[model samples]
Target chain A: MNVRKQFRAGSEFRIADHHPGDKPLSSGDKPADQLRVSGLAEQIAAFQDIFYAEHRRKLLVVLQGMDTSGKDGTVRGVFGRLDPLGVRSVAFKAPSTDEREHDFLWRVHEQVPAMGQLVIFNRSHYEDVLVPVVHGDINEPECERRYRHIREFERMLCETGTVLVKFFLHISRDEQKRRLEARLQEGDKHWKVDLNDLKERRYWDAYQERYERAIRETDTDPAPWYVIPADSKTHRNLAIASVMIDVLQDMKLSYPPPNPEYFKIKVE
Target chain B: MNVRKQFRAGSEFRIADHHPGDKPLSSGDKPADQLRVSGLAEQIAAFQDIFYAEHRRKLLVVLQGMDTSGKDGTVRGVFGRLDPLGVRSVAFKAPSTDEREHDFLWRVHEQVPAMGQLVIFNRSHYEDVLVPVVHGDINEPECERRYRHIREFERMLCETGTVLVKFFLHISRDEQKRRLEARLQEGDKHWKVDLNDLKERRYWDAYQERYERAIRETDTDPAPWYVIPADSKTHRNLAIASVMIDVLQDMKLSYPPPNPEYFKIKVE
Candidate 1:
């Protein structure tokens, strides 16, 4: 089956219908899956050069999920191999005083890719709707307005020279608990510890409900959102790399024709 | 009558229904009308100071019309007296080579007002839809797509803390002919004359049809389109300034509260 059709978060999607452990794209061999992901990452790097040289359209990859849902892992495993000059990674933390003074999207709009660039938002404007609504900082009507704003903003980006791919990294609650315990026990993982993440886990159900609503609201053509079963980190990377390969293949990216002017010039 | 209600080009609007020579905002005295326009300009200036000092929201004013429809004149007469720090006017004559390489809205998006500023587009992205459609450079489907892009783009801007007021300056063919003749016969007006504008007059009917369609498609609550009957330049100025006053007044512009901490500060 086409990976996009399999994982697409369409209007009819229900969050409960997807199982986190389902490895539709994986074979039984763990090393083979990782190897496949590496191969796909290389293909993406190859496409990025031509895409950058074409210099006509842009690409924006938005990764959104719970803290242990492997957003950072997917970035390193899938997009890390691309030419650094043409690719950018932005990890949105809490808004600064200056950013908070403006609308929520002011900082987001600043980081969207220009032509011929691929921008990965480790966490994006999606966090605005999710964290604020889940915490009750934004009420229902205001949340609805933000949803509308996001839909319109993304549609504009897609229409005006950008291809957008949004992923909802879906990991089960049990998997998150197991990962949290692993982090608690491992001394090396102390750097990744955040009391807020542990506190946020208390609102797991609320986050799930909000994430489902956000995905459904923004699951649109020209900018489709994919829900990836992300319990297994290797499979999560595999699934995302597959989606990127499919997206780049669909774009038909190619270098511009050899410049006619080049033939007329000679080295001094 | 409320200026917005009087001139708003909402659903069920027809260009033929609005007479170009109509002076709905006029007092039937030319010098008195001119004085009222000047008074309104001053009101705009006053409102602008508070609006700028409020330092929260942004404003975008779009003026679009046929050549010699008083677009430049309206900018000078209505917006000229405002604080230059907060007001920036952009005249988009033709897209440069770099601009053409990207989408139509790229240049326009870069010029959008940041927080607390008012930006005016003398001729905006609307021209992309208008000129291309009327000149047969764009077919129906492509024109429709451009309109959708524009609607989504403007809707996003409005939702992101920018107040949008779009005006289509309406002028009769006879008025255009008179203006063109004056530009031809007068020495001072020669600098403003463009032979392309004369050539474009041949497609006046096509242009009108496209304009009506564009207005109807984009007339929304957040970004309202006000049709200004621009036969009399002074009345045109009066109507636009009146609308701006209404919009700014609606926003309830005021400076931020005085900082209480100022009481403890002293200079050596």
Candidate 2:
């Protein structure tokens, strides 16, 4: 079952073509599917140990989504099983004043995976395309150029050894309303609710348009995007976990062969 | 039971006075003790949500030890439950050329936790006092100066609202020999067997002495040190998790009160 191929974003990808309510990956039994996700997480951990030992290949997982989408939840559920010492999950927020001085990629480039590392960008360089474009900060010409730069930058990363897995957690407008309203009503979750998220909701369709265009333009073979059906949190984790395991298994990860010299050495 | 105070390193502290094999924090049943660690890990996770919601306190956990003292395992065990988005565990390896150009603390200072974060230093600035000092890179007077700087730096961090929990994972020389022998013999573990770790083993006594002196010198109340007995891997995790929960509890963590204005806002 080529799970990644089924969901991979292509140049012709459209947000409307996908339904947030769909759960192609689910078994229809919610609890059972969640258990399967936990099982997949364990498999990922096993491979992660061997992957770290291989120490030659790099992996970068990019998660892009609208406000209230489960980007943070995906990281916590799937990648959380990997050794914290090895898996670095970086959540990119609004750029700091210092970061604003540099090109968008400058700060992002500083955080890419090195050899034997697995890095997760909670919200990534894709935000440059999503947020600014929705706000009309960049003209269409500039947006296209940024897309080209992204394509070239990602291509370079893939050519250099990074295996990129990008995801757009797709959720519907009504789901966002339910989530936002819940946050407003729930005190414990208020910290997570940036008031700006509600203000930004006014441009939901615009953001969706920008997201669809960005995904279409920058979608490449080496670094393709996966539009995950994220309306159901369990299904989202299940699908993303399935995709992650698929990618890692594709890498054919293994431990390095033992060295003869190491056996000859004595610890004393 | 003031677990931290019982294990705290003070000016009179000496590694010779402690036994790495001790399991004071354990239940004496390996399975039960391991289960307790898991339970404590869950508790830490629960507290973590409220702590993140509180969004005002910072936690910096520094883990330092000899090779195979279980710093990595402790991370995988205790801190693994933390949301990757909220917790960052930094494993400081040998400095790069660019890093060496700056002062020792430069790289470390840049990685400290911000409010609402928990940052773990797998190995940290203390390496400067341990490795370099063990190799005769600095004299006694210079070493004392570094200790003073460390104390002052930690004081400032605590004063600025960062709570520090530093651990010295104490493993016996014999245990390390056994672990190293196993690593050398196992094909799967070879990747983690850095030849430099073997070479440094020759300076075991010297490194221990420096660790003691450094811990004693800088073990101020603002940033006290807890000497964790790590020969028993389960006990090491159990103790660290216990201390972590203790510290987080002391903070009196709670979700911020519901904003009255938030109740009035309509998501649609």
True contacts kept of each: 0.28, 0.00
Query: Which TM-score does chain B of candidate 1 obtain?
Result: 0.98
Candidate 1 residue-wise lDDT, B1-268, digit = tens? 8999999999677887888888888899999999998998999999999989988899999999999999999989999899999999999988887677567877787778888889999999999989989888879988888888888778878867899999999999999999999999999989999999999999999999999999988888988899999999988999999999999889988899999999889977
Supply the TM-score for candidate 2. 0.52
Shift in Å, residue B170, candidate 2: 0.3
Residues B1-268 of candidate 2 have per-residue lDDT tens digits of 6998878888789889999999888777999999999999999989988877787878899999999999999999998988887789999999996455434665787787777888899999999888888888888887776776677567656755688999999999999999999999999999989998899999999989899999989888889899999999999999999999898888899999999999999998
DockQ score for candidate 1 = 0.26
The per-model DockQ list reads 0.26, 0.01
- After TM-score superposition, what is the CA distance of residue A172 in candidate 1 from its true location, in Å? 5.0
Which digits, one per residue and each the tens of the lDDT, describe model 1 over residues A23-94?
Answer: 999898999999999999999999999999999898999999998898888889998899999999999998
In model 1, what lDDT does residue A224 have? 94
List RMSD in Å for every model shown.
Answer: 4.2, 19.1
Best candidate (score: lDDT): 1
